[model samples]
Target chain A: MPTIIFNRPDNRSERVDASAGDSVMQVATTHGVDEIVAECGGNAMCATCHVYVDEGWIARLAPMSEEEDELLHGVAAERLPNSRLSCQIKITPELDGLVVRLPDRQI
Target chain B: MSASGFTPSAGVPHMDIDPFSIEFFEDPHPAHEVLREAGPVVWFDKWKVYGVARHAEVHAVLNDPLTFCSSRGVGLSDFAKEKAWRPQSIILEADPPEHARTRAVLSRVLSPTVMKQLRGSFVAAAESRVEALLAKGSFDAIADLAEAYPLSVFPDALGLKPEGRENLLPYASLVFNSFGPPNQLRQDAIERSAPHQAYVAEQCQRENLAPGGFGDCIHARADAGDITAAEAPLLVRSLLSAGLDTTVNGIGAAVYCLARFPDQWARLRSDPTLARNAFEEAVRFESPVQTFFRTTTRDVEISGSRIGEGEKILMFLAAANRDPRRWDRPDEYDVTRKTSGHVGYGSGIHMCVGQLVARLEGEAVLSALAKRVSAIEITGPATRRFNNTLRGLESLPVSIKAA
Candidate 1:
């Protein structure tokens, strides 16, 4: 099991266990986190499931899908170097102990 | 062409594939290819409708309400006395000033600030649901999570007790299905949900809505003479019907896409920030709400196809999302596509008022999952739940081994 830590803007954090083969969005939606939307049902069409990966972890993940990259174009919040869609991210052994920071708000 | 040259069945010449139907919804690329070849708009006589498979025309109709009036209803049924049950969505159906007023009330009541204020409660409820689903390890993403989440959140926020909430799904499903022809699908939904519409309506009454929620707020606006009392319940009804399924379908669609692209799913886990973009990309790719109809308010020329006044014009959003002309490798699900201009939430005045809320719900769920799950993939065959207008999945079975 990968240990996923959610750091909110207020600096509060919740640590949860992410099972292998589970996409980040599914775990969050099923577990009840407040910050991610996973709208478009995790299809990368709504841009609501955005989160900031810990800067250090960016390269460890696979490259962003063409579809996920395109949908990020007009999000209201500023896009950072570590921006990603939770649904696009799937937990793997390599990503075990990964830490993702949540934006203060999704809307 | 030999059978191998094209799809095994349906010898329709030059037909790529039909992704909207169940047989093809899972993998619609072949059908999209055929529609793209046919032209910007192809009249599918079998479905008795024209498909605007190209991106440009689909976007045009989605954005231009004047040419593509929504008053006739966005479904296949004429919404005539024989088939119609509920009234049209004034906010979704009217033009300009009328639409402007109803939308304004909904906006004032369901504003970003208001939704944000409810974040704590929404998050708490979502967490409980997530915990239950996560415990199961393998479950149906649609019924177990997506549909269950919004049905739990919105009604409570609207002040409905748990008992009053039972009708939400059936009512919304029927309302959206009624947009199609009065076929078995429509008939089944009607018969199933018919008994609940009255109860649903009763809950929307001014006296019934719990104070402090959005429903009460609308009633307050009516009292202030900002809007007619007659309009309050209808607007609330609109919120109930449109708000729930849209988010449900949206969430469901994203899950389906992620399952199809393991690389993309892995990318999302590496950096949860991409979750928002991932959702938008899914909508652009699958278009949960596939098509919205409009009656030509007057004579109109759409991409050189003359549409007479009062003629029904169906806008094919799913086709447009995959249109090759407007996108590079359009069929591929790339999160980086410039999807801001996409018409997934529609355009013009009738754009979804509760979009912020929907986005918030999506972000909360995905972000939480990113922090917990290590790997997620489909464990069983995914099934699509068909509705005339809602393009969404019925089941997405995934296997997870917690990290």
Candidate 2:
């Protein structure tokens, strides 16, 4: 099983295991991790699940989708090069030790 | 096309259900249960449309927009087969590449950030409205609180002029009814709504809307080259279509639930913060926007059943909300239950853009009522407001006690 490391802005961290097919949004939500609102329920329509990927893992992640890219522009927090809608990132064998930094806000 | 090119009557469960009838609309649960039990995908010979009532299939179809397209129309009438009565909504009816731009504009405008900005005004309006209605001691919840609350805030927030704002309900009522077959209801709504439709159409323009409102925000995006100038009004129309009846019915459903289920009201009264969860559970228990039909762009298989190109697949969000396979004691309206993933607002890319604001409105009203009203009792039998697509009350006479 792949594990997702959610680094909360409050300086707390939650490392939870995720099913291979589940997205990081689903993992955070299922484990009751805070700060990932996922307001659109993993639809990529709402940017509430915005997260910054660990710089080391950015290249390994799937390219941001057009819809995700569009909504990312409107996220409440400052957009970063590593900023991604966690709902758009699916868990896979290669992403087993993924680290996603939770934004300070996800309004 | 050959019979082999399309879905053949093999393993598909055929149901004799008439989904559009008033009887079905009034109490759809039994019919929904029947649909779900029949199969994951059922073919309704009466309407000659495929139906998916189970959560998995309906969610799957909605998620895969490329295959189950909306551009053909999210209603009984196929736009490809006939001329649409009005301009197709660039956001609602357009496919991905066409839908993306306008949807991006709306998704941004109606995001949680916008909801946070709109929250204060919405709560203030809700507080004032609830207070005024509670003073009546006994009044119609639907007409007095539900419809009145949304009418007071939403249209004003949308930048609609206050005069002739009575036209909003009729205009929106017709829009919902137009989603079904061309029945007497649809025909009557068309006849009764001509003037209101004209007023609503006029309100969609950049000049007609207030300078600093959501409408202007949308047009500003157009000015910024996010979307074309011509697409702005159509996007406004999408907002009007999704925003009005949905919130009204959502609030109405929550109020009705609290009134009918005294224990649940007691629970909410004890913990006012459950107001949001209470509103959501009510939406799941009594789905406001019951059903929407999506057309298949090509031959598609869902849960072992095949539906052909251009065929209408009725995604029963209402049905899916109560599917026994997906919910525990699915019929109960428990305020404390976590009601995420319910299709009360539909799902996927086409999910209700009106949702965030609607949730805020519902939470505001319910929390205000919970804070002040000790008890809510239906003084008279609730009357149903019939729209082909909307499920809400015409009147709910209620008497409340002060906390």
Candidate 3:
């Protein structure tokens, strides 16, 4: 299991222990974490699950798909180098302590 | 080649069928086969537009909205070139930045927290409706269950006045029909839609909406400077346009599926938690929202075919959901399948905003029924509701055996 830390917009931190195959968005949705909206239900269609990955974990995460990148271009919040649709990031044991900061809002 | 010697950009096929015809609406699978098999992108000669039917192409087009913009319009009559029948949707018809603002307000207003608060009331309403219908033994599923549940709950949630609430369906039907070509279907819908359309517009005014309702919340956002006051009513209209009809048809699709496939009903009955998946599978198997048009922003290549700038590209959402290249045994109505990626709800930025409400309503009704009903059997042939875009049963006669 990988432990994912979600730093909320309100500065609250919630740690979720997720299995390898479950995406970060799925873990947030399943555990009722309010930070990630997952509006398209992790389809990478809507950018509601936008998050900023800690610089250290960025390289460890899987590469973003073209579809995911295009969707990121439309995120309501400002797009950053580490900005990612949380749905695009699958949990892995090697990246056990991944940190993601939820945007102020995911439109 | 067209009369102008405009052959589809190299290898892109042309189709002459009227996708809005009653025959096509009744049974679209064959036409879907033709569209998907013709090419990834095909020109609809009748409407002088291009269409994409394969899942991959449809998915790609939806994700890449910059190439296929919705701001001009997501219907046959482009707002840029034609007179809009009504004020365009602030959310659905706009591109990024403008779209992002309205969408953010809506997403925040209808967030999971709101859904959680709405659940108890929605479930209570669903249980009551089911109880009443069960007492009848046999009934029209569309009117008795599907239409009845959403009509009761969604409107109340919006804090709409009970009077003239019947206008929602006709108004929605007209809105969806307007997305297709200006044919007999759209004309007829327009003629019958005047009064209902007026009623919908009137209800969107700030004074008409109740305090603490969804519509009021949208108005509040305007007051808060998040969105302009002028944009407020249109956003409310967007909700009125996008919310009800799809869910009614969605529930109808689910009931129709469960009745037609009793084994699936049994599967749902055995594990009542499959209620949401069952509703989603129903959406996949019998897509309620059949099609939406997207115009090309510039000449673009899709699947090795070039579509010219400003050309309309009709994305067959329903057809894409059932595309064989995407789903194995796509036609089968199986509740247990992992239906995460289906395009039943249109994909990308313009996806159905009220889907969570629809899902909650579907789960509420299906869960209540699954717990109380052992079987759902069709008593008569289901009659199709003809619409330019939406596909659903007008009447589904069924008899349920109580659990």
Using TM-score, rank the candidates from best to worst: 2, 3, 1
lDDT tens digits, residues B224-275, model 1?
A: 8878989888888887888798889887877777777878778878888776
| Residue ranges of candidate 3 with Cα displaced over 4 Å | A1-85, A88-107, B1-7
Cα lDDT, model 2, residue A60: 95
lDDT of 2 at B402: 88
Provide TM-scores for the models.
Answer: 0.73, 0.91, 0.84
iRMS values for every prediction: 8.8, 2.8, 7.0
Cα lDDT, model 2, residue B330: 92
lDDT per residue (tens digit) for residues A1-107 in model 3: 78999998888899989999888888887776765766466655557789999999898888987657766776768899999988888787887989999899764
Per-residue lDDT tens digits for candidate 2, residues B1-403, read 2122344457998888889999898889899999998999888767778899999888888889999889998998889887877788887888898787788888777866677678899999988887887788999999889888998888878887778887777888888999888888888987787797788788889988897678888999999999888888888888787788888899999999999999999999999988987998888999999999898888777877766777888989988999878888899999877566788887888888777788888999999999999999889999898889999999999998889
Best by DockQ: 2
lDDT of each: 0.71, 0.85, 0.85
Better of 1 and 3 by TM-score: 3
Per-residue accuracy of model 3 over B208-301 as CA lDDT, tens digit each: 9999999999999998999998888888898888799999999999998888887898899999988977988888888899898887877788
lDDT of 3: 0.85
| DockQ of prediction 1 | 0.03
